[model samples]
Every structure is written in C-alpha cells, then in structure tokens.
Target: MRRVSEANGLRIWVDGDLRDEATRVDAVARFQTLLGILRAWRSEAGELRDEQRAGLGEGPVCDEAGNQFLSIGPVRTYTTFGGEIEWFAECTRRGVGMSQHLRNALWLNGRLNRTAADFYMIHEYAGVEFGGSLGIRDKLKLSTNSQGRLTRAANNLSPLEGGRHAKQSGEAGMTLDEQRTYVADLLRRWINLHSAA
Candidate 1:
C-alpha cells in the first residue's frame, strides 16, 4: 500500500493490484477500518488533552525555585485539534545533557502506558550514570529487589499483570499504577537534582 494523499485531517492510501473486484473490495474495506481506528485514536487523544488542560492550567509548571519544568500547549495542525507539551527542568549539571530517554519516559507516563514508561526508565534511562558512580536507579534509592520486580513487571514476567508468562504462585509485584507513581516521583527528583546542579 502507498499513501495517495493527506488532506483535511484524512489520509488516503491506495493498494496496488486492485484490478480484481474482490481485491478492490478488500482494499476499500481495509481502508475504512484504518480510517475508523485513526478516528477513534484521535478522539481519545483529544479527550486526554482536554482532561490535562482542565487539570493543569494554561501555563508552564514551575518548580519551587521558580524554574519552569513543563509547559503544555496546542499542536499546530491545519485540520486537527491536538495538544503537545514540553517537559524539562533547566539542566544546570556540568556536562550533563537532558536525556531523550527521560523525556520519552515522561511522555509515555502522560499517555498512561506505565509498562512502556517503566521499560524506558529501566532499560534506557537508568542504565547511564549521569556523571556519577551511581546510575539513576541507584540515585533513586531503588533496592536491588525493587529493581528486579520492576524489571520483571516491565519485561512480561507475570501474565496476571499484562505479562506474557502465566502467573505463578505468590508472584507479587508492583501494579502498573504503583509503578507509574514510583517512576514519576523518581523522574521529578531527577529533574530537581539537575535543576539545582
């Protein structure tokens, strides 16, 4: 399939080898399905943006020291209503740049995908020590056991909690909501530490 056009918030893709009636019908059906899914996703995203705007006023969130950390605004699109937010505390640490992993983890957290958020934190952001001997996980004071639990949860160790494997007896781990809170707090602390550097 190839994209034919995108106009007025709608994208059109055309598939090759549609000379046959059955193939043409199938292609049209598939296109309709894709359009439906896009519409639903867009609607959900818009609702989330509305909720965020209502909860957080139309202004940048500032830290206690009056440093801006996050700012939310509309996405400039010609035909769709969307939102985007920039989140980053001013990094004052010498030779320490703001990591994209941290930014992506924070963004995924806002999307309510705790599993992906935790994966980014554990696999990407936590592995690198920002100019210190301790990695981000260590800086966050996450115990070895806690780190293992988070890794297990993010890597699909328990089927009961969105994991791939069947749930074992007494395989307790932090719930997705709990992980969300924990990761968010850690990211906040990280931002604060960098802000004060």
Candidate 2:
C-alpha cells in the first residue's frame, strides 16, 4: 500500500473507531473501567498465547489443513480490540496536556455520562511529546488508524471556539483510509475462513 512521507503534511489517520466518536456518548468513568478490564484481559490472554506459542517452537500457529479455530480466532478478535484500545487509553496521554485533549468533553453531557477520550495515547512520556507536540489532531489521526478503525462513529468534531482540535500535523494522502479498508477486509476474511471450521 502507498504511504505518505512525512513530507506530505501528514493526513494520516488510524481508522480505529478510528474513532474519538460521539464524545457525548461516553463518560470518563467508563473509560476508566474499560482501562481496568483491558489490563486484566491482557494478563490472561498473554498466558494463553504463551502456552500456544511454546508448543510451536518457532513455527506458525497452523497445521497442513489450515489454522486452529478454537485457539486463534476468538482470542484474536477479543484480545486485539481489547489490548489496542487499552494501549491507546493508557499509553498515549498525560498531565495538563491530558485534560486539554478532551477539553470539549466537559461541555458535553453524555446520556450515559461517558465520552470517547479526545486523545489516544501510544506513549506516555513527557506531557509535551504526545499531548503537546503531537496534540489532538495527531492523536485522533493515530487513534483512527489503530483501535479506532474497529469502531463505527464519525465524531471528529473540531469547530467551536475552544472545540478546536489541538494542532498537530494531520497527514495528507489516501493511504490511511485505503489501508483501513484493506486490512479490515483481510481480517474479516481470515476470521470467516478459519472460524467456519
């Protein structure tokens, strides 16, 4: 697939919920709960994976017929979405920088008292690196590409006075969208083909 170089003003997006969706639909408390669940699952899932891989001893997780439906399929579908979104929530945010990412969410009174976080974190180093330099624009873009790709929403709202997305370099190109479709399709195919067994 074609990738835009850093030279291209960077229209990159994760296509994850590629989300950041109806901030009005979620609550910060829920995001906190979601984070906890993911943490537990990650530990459990890793154990199962390690057990499966240990047997393979540097081989593929397949036999001559095809793949293991009992093992890989369900685990992956659940684990991936589970882990990645957690990674976003946990890893990619921080500090005074953190509050600013979801600045508009304060104005929103979600029915459920929850809102998708404004920024998705991939790293949580200093406040400025991910939250400041990369900022809201880039977080949504990266979030949209990662776990956000799986979600189905279009709440990239950045139009009010303070509602502005933090300024980061949003990419310029079609790669993010194209790759999202292709990979989503591939994952669907892989699951259908294997799970049927």
Candidate 3:
C-alpha cells in the first residue's frame, strides 16, 4: 500500500521558469477551480472507488489532530508528505458523463500549466476489470496521446479484444451519453498526451 501510494502520487517539478505574477495566480486559480468542479462532479456521479477511499483516507488533507478534512486542498505545492506539485486530483473511472473529454483537454492542457512551459500529471486507476476474474481482462494501459483511435490498435493486442464490443454491450451497454462518458473518462485516464509551451 505504501509503495503504491508513493508511486501514484503526483510530483510536479518546476525549472524556475515560473514568471509573471498574474499568470501564476491564474494558473493556481485554474487548478483550484478544476479541483472544485471535479469534486462536485464526483459527488453527483459517485466516486470510482469508495473502498479505496476508505483505506487511503481523504487526501491533500490533514486534521489538527490528524483526522479528516472532508474537503481537502486539491492543489498543494510543497508537502511534508508528498513533493511539490499542482494536485492530488481524484480520478473518476465510473459514471463520468460525456462532454468531460473536451473539458479534460481544457483543464489539463489549458489549466495545469498556466505559468510554466509544461508539467507532468500522474494518475493510476485500480486497474480495469472485464470479467469477475483479473487475469485475462482488458485493463486500461497508458498511451502517448489521448486520441482513442491511436490506442485502439494497441488494445486489440489483448486476447479479450476478440469479443470486446459484444462483451461490452452485454455487460453494460452505454447509451450514446454513457458511451461518450466512459470513452472520455478512459481517454483522460490513459492519455499520457501532454501539452507544450
């Protein structure tokens, strides 16, 4: 658990190029807003894993007595625990409706690096589940970009790819909205696709 927690945390590094006071504030505000909006969004739809939440406890948070903060800081800079970075943005793998994909582009690329040339965001899902069993499922893996087409070929490499559409339809058929929602979520989660200055 400690290893996963350490490996999964976001560690943002700045190269001293953070200039312009307003840009810095706007950047900070954007991250702040994204966290707020996403939190509301998650509340409406339900978080992906309540079990994980239970074990991990709330994040970016500390109690005066080391308990719970309820709504913790999403974008924390320096930390006695984690390193300097923008956020501990919680991921939502389920129930994220459509239109979020476009929003993700706007937030991650548009918001995450307001004062710098670029930044890195690290996200880890509990891993994808196809069947009740874990061994032969088509779990999501990271990609170089957010474009779904580019990654589809790679995903097809899995033996499970043979009946994915049918299996997906059988298990949980996404309405067009659900389809777009999960697709967008998957895109945001897997896309290593970063932005430049």
Candidate 3's TM-score reads 0.20
Using TM-score as the yardstick, the better of models 1 and 3 is: 1
- In order, candidate lDDTs are 0.46, 0.30, 0.31
Q: Give the higher-TM-score candidate: 2 or 3.
A: 3
lDDT of 2: 0.30
Writing each residue's lDDT as its tens digit, candidate 1 over 1-197 gives: 23235542334455567687877876655544333222222322322344445434444577899887666565533342333111221231211255555444444444432343334353346456453224654565656666666655665546545454464444446666556445555555655565556
Error of 3 at 67 (Å): 22
Collision pairs in model 1: none
Question: Residue 159's C-alpha lDDT in candidate 1?
Answer: 55
Off by over 4 Å in 1: 1-97, 116-123, 129-134, 156-160, 164-170
Tens digit of per-residue lDDT, candidate 3, span 1-197: 01146675423333334787866776665554444334323312212244124323444456689874664323323233452112223232221232344244334433321211111111112121212113112334433333232223223322243223322322222222222343335434432121110
Worst 10 residues of 2 by lDDT: 106-115
lDDT of prediction 1 = 0.46
Evaluated at residue 70, the lDDT of candidate 2 is 34
Best by TM-score: 1
Please give the lDDT score at residue 56 for candidate 2: 28
